[model samples]
Target: MDMEIDLSNLGTVNTMFAALFSKLGVPIKTTISPTVLEEAMNGIVTVRPLPVGTSATGKVDKQCAHFFGVTISEEQAHSGIVVRVTSPAQSKFKLLYFEQEVNGGYGLALQEDSQKTGKVTSAGMYFLHFQVYRMDSTVNALAMAKDPEAAFFKRLEGLQPCEVSALKPGTHIFAVYGDNFFKPASYMIEAMCAKSYEETTERLKEIESKILAKRNDLRQFETEYRKALARFQEVTNRYTQEREAVDDMLRERDNIHCSFTTERTLVNPVGAGCSSSRYTTEHSIPESPENGSLDGRDKSGKKKWFNLNLNRSDKKA
Candidate 1:
C-alpha cells in the first residue's frame, strides 16, 4: 500500500492550526511618541508626563498602550526585579505585563511614524500578558474597560497600585494605559531587585507560623459555634413543651362552661301561728350554685333575721 499527503496548502493549514491553538491578541491601535517611550525604557527611576498618546488629530487617545521596558541584568535576574508604577492621587493608570519572546520581533517600535499613525502596526514578540504581581487577581485591563462609565468612577478615584515581579534575565515589557475613558497624567515608574533568598525564606517561615495560629483560632471558633447551637436547641425544645402544656390547660378551661342562675325561695318562720308582739315573718333563700355552695350559713331552724323578702304583705313587729 502507498500513502501520500499533499502539502501544497501549507500556509493555509498552518494558519488554521495557529487559529485553533493560539489566543486572539489585542491589536496595538494606540501609541505614544518614540522619544518619550525611549526614555521610559530606562529601569529603576521615575518617568514623568505619563507618556500619553495623542491621535493624528491631536486628541488624547484613551486606547493608547505606552510600552515601558525594564532590562534585568544577569545578576538582577537571578534575584528577580520588582516593577512598580505609582500614579498621583485622584488620577490613575493600569499596567499590563508581557514577557518578550526569544525571537525578538522589534517589540513595540520606538519610532515617530508609529505615534503619528495613532496605531502600532508593528507586532511585539511578547506573551504572558496583562497581569500584575501585586494587583488583585480578578482585576485586569479588559475587565476595567468593560465596566460602564458611571460604575467605574470609584476604581479610577483612588491610587491604582501596580506592581510586577519579573524573574527572567531579559528586557521585560509593560504596557501602561488609561481606561474607562479617563486619561492618565504624570506618574512614576520604579524597578528594583527582589529580596535575597535568605530573607524570602524567613518571610515564608513567618507566614507558616501565622497560618498555624489562624488554624487554631478557627478550631476554637468551631467549638464555640457547636456549643451555642446545642444550647439553642435545648431552649427551643423546652419552649415548645411549655407552650403545649399551657395550650392543654387552656383547652380544659374552654371545655368547662360556667352559667349563673339567681332564684329566690320564700320561707315562713316556724312561729307563724303565734301573733304576739314578736310576729313571724317571711324570708328569702337563694338557690345554691352547681359548682359551689353558699358561705357556711345555718339553713336549719335557728332564728335568723333577713330583710330580703319579696312578699312584703306580712307584717312584722
Candidate 2:
C-alpha cells in the first residue's frame, strides 16, 4: 500500500492534526515533539495492541487500548520530541516501566526548540515516575525503642519487650516478659489500621525543595509530598491517553493530518488519506478519554505544568 508517510516535514502534519482535532471537540495534550515522533518512526509503524496504523487512546476515546501519545511541532522541520510515562499495572508490570525513550536525537531538538519558541517549555524526556516508598519493620522497631516516652515496659509498668518486626497487615497478639517482672502478661490488641500501610508504604519522596522552607514535621513532609504528587499525577494522566490514540486506528493515528495551535485545539484531522478506513466505518474506535485531568485539573481548566515555570520543574524529564 502507498501508506508510508514522509516524516521529513513532520511539523506540517502536526499542524494539520491539531487543526482538525479542534473542530472535533476533543482537546488533547501533545508534549512530545514531532522530531521525536519522526525519529522514532523513521519508516516503521505499528508497535503493539493493533497491527495497522498508529492507533491510540485519546481524550475522547478512553477504552480499547492502554497506551497512546502523539508528537507535534511547528518549526516546519522535525525538531521536537514528546515524552510519555506510564505506571506499572496488572501482571505485565515489566511492560509498564518507569522510563521508555523514543531513541535517537528526536527528543533533543524538541527541547531546543522549546527554548526558542517556548511552545514546549519543559525540557526533559517525559517518563513515567513512580514514587514508591518501602516501610521497613526495623524502622518501626527502632522508632519505638528510641522514643523515651514509649520505650520498654515502663509505660506498661513491668514487662520485657520483644523486638517487633515490620507491621503486618493483620491482627497481632503477643506476650511480654521482663527481668525483674512478676510474671508474663498476654495482651491482645486488634490492629486494623490502614494508615500504617497507606501513609508509609504507598507514596513517598525525598526532601529538597525551597518552597517548604525546610522542616522535620508532619506539615513540612505533607507540603513537600503534595507538590511532587501533583506533578506525578500529571504524568500518569498523560500516559493513560495512549489508549485512545491506538483505538481509532487509521484515522486517529493519521501522521499527515495532525496539528496543534496556540489555542490548544487540534487541526487537519483524519481523511487527509490514511488508507486505514479499509476496516469498517463502525469499527468501534477505542475509548481515548474526554477530560484529561488529575482531579478538577483537565476538567476545571486549571493551569498546566507550563504555567508553573518552576526553576526545578523546568528540569527535563
Candidate 3:
C-alpha cells in the first residue's frame, strides 16, 4: 500500500523549507536547471565553484550559481500580477549575486554602485539586483549547461522592488549565485507575489463603481420609503377624519332619539301634542256611565248634561 503524505498540514518553517526543496528537486551538478520554483515557497541551494571556463565570462555570469525556471501563465500575468524573487536576510544567505538571467546566455549586469569602496563592477557588490528577462521558449537545461553563454536570451528591463511586475506571459529563467571566491555557500531563495500599481488602481476603480451603485440603490430605496410613508400618512389621516365624522353622526342620531324619548315621557298619551293635564282633559273622550258619568255628572252629585246629538253635530261642523 502506498502511504499518502499530507503536505498541507506541515506547518513548521523547517518542514516547509524541506518540503519546498524537495518540490524543487535535487540540486543539479551539471547545470540541468530546475523548473519547480513557486510563489511563497522558500527553498535553499548550495553553490560550488565551477570550472575555469564555465559561465564566468562577463560581469553578470558568476563562477558559482544555480539556475531556476519560473513560469508565469497568462492568468497570472494579467492585472499586473508580479512574481517577486527575494533572499531572506535572516536566512544567512547574503547574496554575492542574484539576478534574472537569460535562459541560454549570460545574465545582464547591474549598474555599477559607485558608493561601495571595493572592486567597482556590479559583481563585487554583495547585494541582490533584480531584473526581468524573456526567452524564446522553454530552456534546454543540458544545452544551456554545455553552452551557458549563448546569445538567445534578451534582457528586457530591470525590476524595481525585486520583482518581475509586468513580464510577458511565459516561462522565465533566473540565476542565484554565491560569492565567487571558490567557497561553497548555502543560500535561501524566497519567492513572493505582489500586485503592480496599475492593478491596484483598476481594483480601486472597480470598488468605487460598486460602492456608487450601492449608494444609488440606497437612495432609490429611501425615495420609495418616503413615498410609501406619505401615502400611509394620507390614508391614516383620511381614516381618522372619516371615523370622527361617523362618531359625530352617531352622536347626532343618539341626541335625536333622546329628544324623542323625552317628548314621549313629557306629553300625555291622550293628547300627543300637549304637555299639561288640562289640555289632556279637554282633548280626552267623555267618561262613560260605568266610569261614573251618565250625563257628565260626577260622583260629587253635581249634575251637568252633555247632549250626545249636539256633540255629534259639533264634530260634523
Candidate 4:
C-alpha cells in the first residue's frame, strides 16, 4: 500500500529522543533535519530525521504526531480493494507500513508521501508483500506486518489480513527517514474479530417483520377463497333441487296424461326464468333446528332463521 506517510516532531525532537532512549534503557541519540522541523512547525506535510546513537535499547514510547492533512480512503473492487493514503501540505515525507514480531523483531516498508500537499495525489507504491508474521510461523501459514520506517524496511516473518492476533496484538511503530533525519511513527492497527450482537439482532427483527406480513397476507387470501367457494356451492344446490322438483311434478302429471311429457321435450333444458339472489334482509342464519326455539326466543313473533325466496313458477293467469 503506497499511502502518503507523515512524521511530525510535535516540536520536541531532541527531548523526545532522550525520553525514548531513557525509557528503552539504551544510550541512543537522534538528530532532526532543519527542513523537516520547519515544515512541521508550519503545519506542512513533511518527514522527520532518524539519527542513531550506540545503545542496546528497547522500544520507545510512541510519539503521537499526525501527518498534516492525511487520510486513508478506499474503493472496493472485483479482485480486491484499492486504498489510498493522502497528504494535505506540500513537500516530501516518508510513509511506512509495519508489524511487530514476537521474537522482538520489527518489519518495515520504505515509501514516500504523496507530493500533492493539502491535496490528494495518485502516485504511490504498489507493493506485493502482503503479510507480516512471527518468526515461528511458515511463509504460507501466515504473513506479518512491517514497520513504518519509510527509509530501510525490515522483512516481515508472516502477516494475516487486518487481524493482529497472528502476531503481537499491540501497538507497532515505524520510523521514516527524510533523506537523512529519522522520524519514528506509530500505527494503531488491529486484527480482531467482530463485536456486539445488538446489530445482528436488529437485522433479524427486520427480516422477521417482512416474513410475518407475507404470512398474514396469504391467510387473508385463503379466507376470501373459502367464502367464495361456499357461496358457489349454495347456488348449485338450489339449482339441482328446483330441477328435481320439476321432474317429479312432470312424473306425477304423467299418470294423468302420458302424451304431455313427449310434447314438452324438456323445454331446451334452461332459460325458464328462475331468478336466484342472496337474502340479506337482516335475518340471522339458523345455527340448528332448536336454535331460535324456546331456547333462543320467547313466545313472540320475532323472525329466527335466514331464508331466500325463489320465483320458480307463477300461478298461470
Q: How does each model score on lDDT?
A: 0.40, 0.28, 0.37, 0.34
Candidate 1 vs 2: which has more lDDT: 1
Measured by TM-score, how close is model 4 to the native structure?
A: 0.19
What's the TM-score of each model vs. the native?
Answer: 0.35, 0.15, 0.23, 0.19
Q: Write the per-residue lDDT of candidate 2 for residues 171-234, one digit (tens) a residue.
A: 1111110110112111111112223233432222232222122323444555666688799999
**Which residue pairs does candidate 1 place in steric collision?**
none
**RMSD of each predicted structure:** 20.2, 46.8, 25.2, 28.0
| Clashes per candidate, residues 3 or more apart or on different chains | 0, 58, 0, 35
Question: How much is 309 displaced in model 3, in angstroms?
Answer: 99
Which structure is stronger by lDDT: 2 or 4?
Answer: 4
The TM-score-based order of candidates, best leading, equals 1, 3, 4, 2
**Candidate 4 regions with alpha-carbon error over 4 angstroms:** 1-83, 117-317
In model 1, the number of clashes is 0
Residue 185 accuracy (lDDT) in model 2: 18
Q: Model 3: per-residue lDDT, tens digit, 121-221?
A: 12112111223222211234334445543212211111122223254555444445442222233333333223335554456457645654664576566
Residues 1-317, candidate 4, lDDT per residue (tens digit)?
22211223435576565556434433222333445434444534433222111111121123223331112212111112112333232222334444334544433433333233345321222221122111212232211223233111112222222322122222323333332123332222111111223354345447545544654565566577668879999999999999999988876565445333323333332333222222343557767535666645543323422211122223332
lDDT of 1 at 18: 39
User: Which is the leading candidate under TM-score?
Assistant: 1
Model 1 weakest lDDT span, ten residues long = 120-129
Off by over 4 Å in 1: 1-61, 90-92, 106-166, 196-317
